[model samples]
Target: MLNLLSGFIGLVALILMIPAVIPLLGALNWLFVPLALLGAFIGMLSSKKGGQNFCLIVAAFGALRLFLGGGII
Candidate 1:
């Protein structure tokens, strides 16, 4: 489905966009948070199954980030 495809693409974009675009452009990370959130939310809301998958993906990512960074969100 398009939802699934879009969500997957968005996730890739969310993860890769900053690392790929920020350094060369001298962009700030603060500006990227909204973009990442928007992409992840829209990507997650595309379909029922995609929503569920996105929820799981978010949880996993959060846990990993928390553990690795050892800080509060």
Candidate 2:
């Protein structure tokens, strides 16, 4: 149950990031990145294979966005 919830959260975060890619919504990335991280953390804590995979993907994309946006150095 927790695993499913965590995976769903990660998937939702990824979906939210789509709009953030647009110039008008670019600033939204800041919000989405944290959301993604939260989802990833929750998923990790769930300790389920499916949740872990979802979290990994979300984390990777979030990190890439942060790096590209100069949030990370």
Candidate 3:
């Protein structure tokens, strides 16, 4: 489960980095790619709480992009 989740996280981050700019947001989308990879590793290697924490981080960032609206520039 950990490995699968980690891979998925990285994949999602990479995909998000593909678009080119938006009306309201900026180019901060690609930044989450590395972050997601790191979080995935942390989630796979650390304690249960640590994994949860990483997942929370990923979720929060994703939420920010979706809710607040951010773009790739």
Error of 1 at 38 (Å): 2.5
Question: Model 3 over residues 1-73: C-alpha lDDT tens digits?
Answer: 6655665565566556445235444345546645675656656664454544555566556545644553332
Q: lDDT per prediction?
A: 0.47, 0.72, 0.54
Clashing pairs in 2: none
Candidate 2: lDDT of 59? Answer: 68
- Score candidate 1 by lDDT: 0.47
Clashing pairs in 1: none
* Top-down TM-score ranking: 2, 3, 1
Rank by lDDT, highest first. Answer: 2, 3, 1
lDDT of 3: 0.54
Q: Candidate 1 or 2, higher lDDT?
A: 2
Q: How displaced is residue 35 in candidate 1, in Å?
A: 5.1
The list of candidate 1 runs beyond 4 A from truth reads 1-6, 13-36, 55-59
lDDT-best of 1 and 3? 3
User: Per-residue lDDT for 2-72 in model 1, tens only?
Assistant: 46654664465446434533334323333433444555566555655563355345444534443444433
Candidate 1 residue 69 C-alpha distance from true site, Å: 1.6
